[model samples]
Target chain A: MSFEISVSRRLGQGVIALDMAGGDGITALFGPSGAGKTSILNMVAGLLRPDRGRVAVAGRTLFDGDAGIDLAPERRGAGYVFQDGRLFPHRRVRANLLYGARLATPEARATGLDIALDEVVAFLGIGHLLDRWPRTLSGGEAQRVAIGRALLACPRFLLMDEPLASLDAARRDDIMAVIERVRDEFGLPTLYVSHDRAEVERLATRIVAMPQRDTA
Target chain B: MSSFLALTPDDWEIIRLSLKVSLVAVALTMPIAFGLAWVLARLRFPGKLLLDGLVHLPLVVPPVVTGWLLLLAFGANGPAGRWFADWLGIEFMFRWTGAALAAAVMALPLMVRAMRLSIEAVDPRLEGAARTLGATRWRSFLTITLPLSLPGVLAGAVLGFARSIGEFGATITFVSNIPGETRTLPIAIYSALQVPGGEEAVTRLAIISVLLSLGALIASEALSRRAGAGRGGHVL
Candidate 1:
C-alpha cells in the first residue's frame, strides 16, 4: 500500500470521513463537489489536522492522532500541487521550479533522489519561461510550472488537488498527459482528487469513491 | 532666487542636523515597527485590542503629552533611564539621542499603520504553499510575506522620515533645543521667527519643510499604489 488513510473531522456542522488503502500507482478520490475531496488531500499533506485518524504514505507514518505523531508540512515531504497553482508571485518561473529542490534533505541528495532543475524544466516544457514571472504565464503554463515545482521536491508521494480543474479542454488534455507521464516514468505514488469521473477513469489505476455527507 | 540660494552656514547646519536626526530615528524604529505591525496584523490574543490601542496612542495624544510620558519613563533619573545609564552608559536627557528617541516615538504609529496594512494584504495561502514545498514557517515568511510587503515597508519608512523631520513639540519637551545638537528644522524655523530681521530665514526654512514633507507624501502614495499592484492589482 502506498497510501493508508483513515480519518474523520467535523467541519461547520458537517462531518467528513474517509478510509482508503491505495495502490503503488495512481489512486483517485472520485466524488462530487463539497464531498470533502480537497479536505482529504489536505489531511494527507499535513495541512489539515484530522480529529482522529492515521495517515501513512510509503510506509512512513505522517500523522497518527492516537499515537500523538503529527509532523509539520515541510517535514512530511508531500509534493502538493494545488488547484490554483499557488506560485510565488515575486519569483520567476526558474526560481519557483527550484524552490523545493533547494531545500531537499542532504540524505535525499546523497542518495540521488533529488530531481535536477534542468530536467524538470525540460520535462515540463517550461524552458522558455525561465525568466518570466508567475503573473505573466498563461493558466496552463502556470499549472505546468506548479507541477514541475512539486516534482523537483522529489517527494515520497504526490498529492494533486484537481490539477486540471481550471484548464480548458485542450489544456486539460495537456495536463492529463503530463500526469500520465509522471505516473509511468517517475513511478511516484499519487493521490489525485477530481470530481470528473472520465478524467479519473482515464488516469487512476484504482478509484476510491467519496460519499457526500448531508449537513443538518 | 539669489536670496534663497544664499543660505547662511547656520541654515545648512540646521538642515544637516534635521536630516541626521530623522534618518537615525527611522533607522532605529523600522525593524521594531515591522515586528509590532506583524504582531498586530497576524496575531490575536487576549490583549490584542489593548496592544493595538497602546501603539496608536502617540498618534492620537498631544505630542507634548507623549514627550512628558517619555521623560517620566526614560528620563535620567527614571528607572529605565537609570538602568541604561548604569549599564549601557547611555543618556537621553538633553542630547540629540533624546531628540531622535522623541522623533521615533512620534513617528512609530504612522510606520506601524502602513506596515500593518501591507502585511495584512499578503495571502496566507502563498505561505502555506511555500511550507508544503519544504520551506519552514520562518523561511516562508522571509521569502514570501516579507518580499510581498516591501512596498508598504518602504512607504512606512518614508512616512516616518517625513514625520520625524517635522517633529517639534515632543523633541523640545524631552530634549531642550541645543543649537547644533538638538535644534531640528522646525525648532530652527521657530527660533528664526523670534529674531529681528529673521523673516527671510523663517520663510526659507518653512518652504524647505513644506517641500520635504510634500515630496515624502508623494513618494509614499506612489509606493502604496505599487504595493496594491503587487497584490495582483487588488485594492485593499
Candidate 2:
C-alpha cells in the first residue's frame, strides 16, 4: 500500500513544506523538537488543514488542496496518539477505550469488534485496568490505554506523535515493546514521529528527516 | 421548632403556599437560567455586557424597585401583561402566579452566576478530545460538557430555591398579601406583626422559614458534593 503526503504550512517559524512516501512497516519522521513534525501528522489526520497540498493513502485521496477537498477528522479513517494521552477524566478506562469503537460500522471492523477489543486487551495487557478511573493510572498505563483505544477504532493507519516523551526510561522501553507488538500483531502501517535517535533506530523501517526551521 | 401538629390551619396554609410558590418559581427559571449561563460561558456576541448587566440588576437594585419594574412590564395594565391575559386568558393581577414570577426574576441571577462559574471551570480540551473520537459537536456538548458542568447546575438550583423562598418585597409589591391567594410566608409574617395577638403565629412561621432556608443550603452542599464525586471529574 502506498502512502504519500505533500503539505506546505506557514507557521511562525517560517514556511514549512513536507513530503513523504512509504510502503509498509513504521516510517519514522525523525526531527528535532519544534521542527514541524507534529504539524505534518496533524495535517494527515485532518486535524489541521495544510495551507496547500495533498495527502493520499493506498490510492484513496484524503485531502487535495487543488480540488478543495478535505475530510473531517472522524471520516479520515486515521487514529492519532497524542504526546500526552487525552483520556476523558469522567469516564473509566473501559468506557474511554470503547467510546469511539462503538461508533465504528460493521465494515470498519472486518475482524469483529469484540475480537479486536479482546486482541487489543491482550496486545496491550490493559485488561486489568478496565474499570479503574484515569486518574488512578500511571503515565505509562495511560499511554498504553491510549494506544489500545486508537487501535480499537479500526483506523486505516496510525499516527503516533512522541508517544513516549512523557514516560520514564523503564516505561518508555515498556511502551516500545508494546508498539513493536502492535505493529507485528496486525501488520498495521504506522507513521511514528520522534526526535530521539535511539527510538528511530529501534523502530523505524524508513527514516524521513525534517529540515531545520527557517529563521526568516 | 414547633411541631407540625401544633401549627393551626392558618399557619399550615401559609407554609404550604410558600413552598408551592417557591417550587414553581424554581421550575420556571431552571432551564432558562441554565441556557443563559451556557451562553455566557461558551459564546460571545454583541450586547453581551448589556445582557449581563440587566440580568444582575435585580441583585444590585432595591427589591422594591425590582418589584416595580416587574409590575410595569407584567402587570395587567402593562402591554405584556395585557397581551398575555387577553390572549391566553391568564391574569397575574393579584394572583399567586404573579408572586411566582417575581420570585423567579429575583432568583434567576444567582442560578446563572453559579452555573456559569462551573461551566468556565470545565476543561475545553476534554470536549475537543470527544469531538476527535467521532462525537459530533452537539454530542460532545451533551455527553462531555454538560455532565462536567452539573455541579454548578445543582448549586444554582438550590440557591435559586432558597432565594425564591425568601422573596418578600417583590412579591408584596407585585401581588399584595391576599390570604389563601397571593400571601406567602414572608408576607404572612409581615402582616402578623401589624396585628395584635398575632405574635405566636409569627414565631411559628419564622421558625419554618429559617428551617426551610437552612435545609435548602445544607441539601445543596450534599447534592453538589455527590454530583462532583459521582461523575469523577474536576469541578471548576
Question: Whose DockQ is greatest here?
Answer: 1
What are the lDDT figures for the candidates, one per model? 0.90, 0.84
Candidate 2 wrong stretches, greater than 4 Å: A1-23, A27-70, A110-115, A206-216, B1-5, B77-79, B86-89, B226-236
Interface root-mean-square deviation, each candidate:
0.7, 1.7
Name the lDDT of candidate 2. Answer: 0.84
- Candidate 2 retains true contacts at a fraction of 0.29
List, residue by residue over A1-216, the lDDT tens digit for candidate 2. 557989888888687778888778888999999888988888888777899999997677889999988887766667678888888888999998988787676666663223367777887889999999999999999999998888877677888999999999999999999888877876667899999999999997889998876667
Error of 1 at A185 (Å): 1.4
For lDDT, the strongest prediction is 1
**Top-scoring candidate (TM-score):** 1
Lowest lDDT sum, 10 consecutive residues, model 1 chain B, at B227-236
